[model samples]
Target chain A: MATDSKQFDFGFRNGRLRVAWYALLAVLLLVGGYAMWLRLQGGMRSTNLTSITPWGAWVAFYIYFVGLSAGAFLVSTLANVFGIERLHRVDRDALFAAIVSMVVALLFVWTDLGRMDRMWHPFAWRQVTSALSWEVHAYVAYIFVLMTELYFSMRYDLARVAERGTGLRARLAGLLTLGRRQLTDESREADRTWLKRAGIVGIPLAIFMVHGGTGVLFAVSKARPYWNSGLFPVIFIISAVLSGTALVMLLYVLRTRLFDGERVDRDILDRLATLLAAFVVVDVALTAIEALIAIVSLHPHEVETWRLILFGEMSWSFWWFMVGMGWVFPLVLVSKREWRRTPWLMAVAGLSVVIGIIAVRFNIVVPPQIRPVMEGLPHGSYFPSAVEWATSVGMMAVGLLLYTIGAELLPLTPLDGGDH
Target chain B: MSSNDAMPGVPDTPDRAQLDAMVDAEQADPRAELEDVDFSTELGVAMAEDAKAVSRGEITSEEYWQRYDDLAAEEFGEVYHETPNPAVDHDTAQTIEDDVAESLSCTVGSMASIAESLEEPAGDSEGASEDGEDDDHRWGMVIDLQKCVGCDSCSVACKAENRTPPGVSYNVVMEEEHGEFPNVQRTNVPRPCMQCENPPCVQVCPVSATYKMDNGVVNVDYDRCIGCRYCMIACPYGARYFDFGENYDDEVEGAGEITSPEYGVDRGEREPKKSPVGNVRKCHFCHHRLNRGEEPACVETCVGDARNMGDLDDPDSEVAEMAASTRAMQLKEGEGTDPNVYYLE
Candidate 1:
């Protein structure tokens, strides 16, 4: 029942379950709000960032969510662009996830700026060589494109739900539909065509401008050898595909099976898990090649940074979380023919991969920066302060809260993928 | 009383045997050392022996000089003019000048005369002013390795002169030891901003808050800087640093009252998390000091006289001359930054 975007006939019943969900969301909002308050009051001093390690947990989360959003958007294209009816079930969910993650990412980066008040400068004074300046423009444009595409995808559903209901959802749907009461085959065909075009155009934009460009933010830094390479942005794209696939898979299972306690199709679960397993292999392969290139070059500066990532203080993040749970464990669960058929195992694999993606983001940001740019200068080390951790958790909670409220108030799930 | 107190003992001169051994051991070429002086060993010995008499209250210094005058006239009766003494101090300043000149590609005689004329180096394409003027005085420094004792007075003086807040040092000393323990080479590299002709810092600054000045110094416009700190990551030398609104409030006295007039802006009072407080900062070759016809704080306070600052465009300047020396090298030439700072290894 919760697997689709268009609402079904069943209402938000089961008062106790609704209350429990709302309570969890409310607690998250309250606690996360307090942490956010501390951050605003204290400035960057509330974080563990130093002059040496300028970017910390916030920057990590900023990129992590960006990957997830780009990943989710691209996953939606599998249905809208490629006409994959099997994946149609998650299209609206994917779009909503994309929008929410982008919001979380933008906020994280906005606050991470040294002069948060002067955030307008990057827009006002655009320099040609500055990738960061270009990023602002691209991110804003990407958001507009996402919202427009999402509106097109949901217009018919809104019109349908509005005709049948007379409560908050109906009123909101009417206002959103702009008073267009008629629904016909011609209009529905036009909506499908527009959606297909939007998805097609958005594919390259999501792959290159949004996620790959974010990778370029670090790759262009000649000072940090770890990130300066042609392969970096490519790795970012592949990993985005990987994490995006995992996120959609996780959300699908939670929405359908866990929260709603409904049965899901075995074919969808197996195929999604298989896609995730394949992405993990590709992600790990790219990482191995990157490591091999760095290790064999024997450049002390480059080697030291790699060592910091592989065996230094936060080595466990790479060795355990990213490799063991993120890749190997997920790979084992999904690739095994017997386990792949089990819906719970597929969900577990999806959950492990989504958590591991966060670990990937941290390793990418922290380790290279931890090694001093020069030999004698103080090497950086960072563990996000309690406030930083809380704020990040709060932001994640906020993402969930938004998802929950959005799920309830809007037509997020329908029986026929909102087509009829 | 003064003479007696000065030379109370050792009144009697050493005997011939003792003098000869002392001469053989310590004065292998006594005459060479003695040439500039009045050449009278007898008069010198008599004066030394009489010093003991004076110390014993046998005679005064005045009386001693008066008694030795006839011998003193023969001992020190020569007018000497300054001349190169290769037998003693082998390398004079003139010789160094000639050697450095000889090594340069410029005509040997021309290089010697270059001391008086201001001209640019042979290959000076990089670091031209934004206005595309190459004739402007591009300030530069040359750190001499032999002279740099690495006392880090330069770093301290930079802090005091710039009045940078905590964690905002514009200059730093990087030290490392290489080779085997028995034959280890300890090297100290005192790093300031490279002030590259094609600075990556200036290139990456999204707001263009940081820029290369007409004088070839890279400066950050604190008022305009958004504190993105992209420059810090782009800098190959790690010279650019972020001002994370940290202060020496607890560590230093009256910390907030101290702030530099950087970029010639009177940003009064280092408020907690203000313009420069949140902006990126770096060495500007002490442009504020330069406007006042003074060298950088690091150059002014270097105990070893290791750092030299002058107009690289002015060939007559010491920095220009040293920049042309064979030992002169810049850090990270592969980055193609073309740093104005030179290191004489």
Candidate 2:
């Protein structure tokens, strides 16, 4: 225990910081719990949504988390499948985040459902034509792939840790090892093989089935012309990769600085920054092209949708969160070699991208709905109600709580010196 | 000539015990016993059958006598006497006739049944399922824009009949005015569920909860609906609405006590977060009313009488004829939804 403590801290070794983090999470859960209770009692009435605006903040959050999960999993593939050596340090972290984010995404969707009890209906009764139904199955498959990858990636480290001591962490690690305590080279090689296989399967599952399918769910809606473009799904994929890479970069730097008591990996941060910038460039180009076409077409609904995003009441979300933070600021920060060298600067860029993608999701969901499909129908108006914001925060806290507990108990950090 | 001589083919073998037993049986059920009796002629058989009907109280004696008086005279000539039945209570028969008349004028109950029966042939013409199979129809509607007064009565009728919760209107009227202040033309377009042949809502339902019925109406199976509102997003016309469980308890007393029988399901009492309360609901062309041979409430209650519903499959039907006219057009036709509802300019 002394040696392990000397080497690295899992959560916050400073007991006060740990307590504060837990306390913050606990407070959020308490508020969120009350809000969720109200939501359950009041049903859809608690929401400001009308028939014209059937979806709201929860839907945006759902897509946001889906993009995050897909992005994180794709980042993990950088090490597990593509064998990027520097990325190996955060591959397991990214994989775990992917699992947690996916669960959070699904939780958002479940709460958004009118019949939360009937959430299983999508799986039990398969509607071949529904993109959502296909997504339901894909999410299950993706989660399975993620868990399998995470298990194989950690088994060796868990076995090593389990053999060390009689403490609770050791006992937990021993149980997680599933009695496969054989620490032979063959077992390590076999674990790598399983991880690679899972990652291979998961790449397409994450890209085409999970996030791309969510894009298709919108694109297929001929009612909303803004989302009907062929490029929508492609943009979704690119943005997902961008967000995932950014989240992982942020996680790596934060973990190194706060918990691991180690110097941040500059090489990995540089590569991730470059990859994230590339994604951002692609995302910006595609979005610009999409907007240009909509503006040129002069189709009323299309124009109206864009107008809503750019100039409507909620336009601040687009200009500030999406364009400023999501695209411009992050792109500028990551563009410079000197800034990329600064680990905290890279973290800020990553944070900006993460926050910006959330606005991107909101723009995707809310704008098109603001313009009524047919004119003279009451124009839809919406803002996330109190319950909505509270529940969203609570769900995010849940994800953080899960990740915190997992990080403390599991061998998520690489068991090596800072060189790797 | 005696009655027996006139009917020479008849056999007469009267046993006192059998005759008494037969008479007793006739008292029990005149129609059943009379079936065994042999008559001399068709007229005799017809008169005797009616006489038995009168005796069993199936028909009033006056109705029976009025029916056979001329026929009896033709058969029996001078022997036919216009004698009223002593067994029938004339007072009771008069009271029954009076009650029927009073009930028809005083209450909707009997009138509704009468209306139902009167509508039977119309229902058949409108392609009500003859074999109790739904596939025979493609129900349709045609609205004349010129006739619409823009009163929103159709919307009101729809709300009243469906008892849809707030934020869940199955019908709406889109009104617009064109041209300058001096010469303006106002247009009111009443919208209901288009019941599209290729409904985007049905195509995107994750649970197959909302589906296009063979009868040309799109149905939302509330039991199966998870209420994701995907169909609401998918629909081009914005025809679908989610029932958020809001009721008119404040304005109308006992509003929640009785719910509209939509899709022929009696979803009694608008309970909070029940099947329909949590489900996406829309106009099913008043399927419950359609099942009972009645028009959709919007069509029935349209003050201007602008709406007409009929079998689109039937070329001779009013809606089909109107739909075929040059003035007939569908909203958002470029979307290729192939809406069942048509508007005549």
lDDT of all predictions: 0.80, 0.87
Per-residue lDDT over A1-420 for candidate 1, one digit per residue giving the tens place of the 0 to 100 score: 233333343334466877888788788778888998887777667878777787778988999999999999998888889977788778878888898999899888877777888888877887888888778888888888787777778777778777776688778878877766567878768878998888887888888989999999899988888898889998888888888888888888777764445577677777788888888989999999988898898987779988888888888998888998789999988877778778777778888988898899999888877878878888888999988888888888888878777766666554454334
Residue pairs clashing in model 2 are none
> What lDDT tens digits, residue by residue, belong to model 2 across residues B213-236?
778888888889998999999999
Docking quality category of candidate 2 according to DockQ thresholds: medium
DockQ of each: 0.44, 0.60
What does candidate 2's lDDT look like per residue over A1-420, in tens digits?
A: 244544423666668888998999999999999999999999988888888999999999999999999999999998889988788889889999999999999999999999998998987787899999899999999999999999999898888778864477788889988989888989989999999998999999999999999999999999899999999999998888899999999988887776776788788889999999999999999999999999899999999889889999999999999999999999999888988989999999999999999999999999999878987888989999999999999999999999888887777886764123
lDDT of 1 by residue, B131-200 (tens): 2254378889999988888788999999999888778888999988899979998889999999999998
How far off is residue A389 in model 1, in Å? Answer: 0.8
Off by over 4 Å in 1: A1-14, A258-261, A418-420, B1-135, B179-184
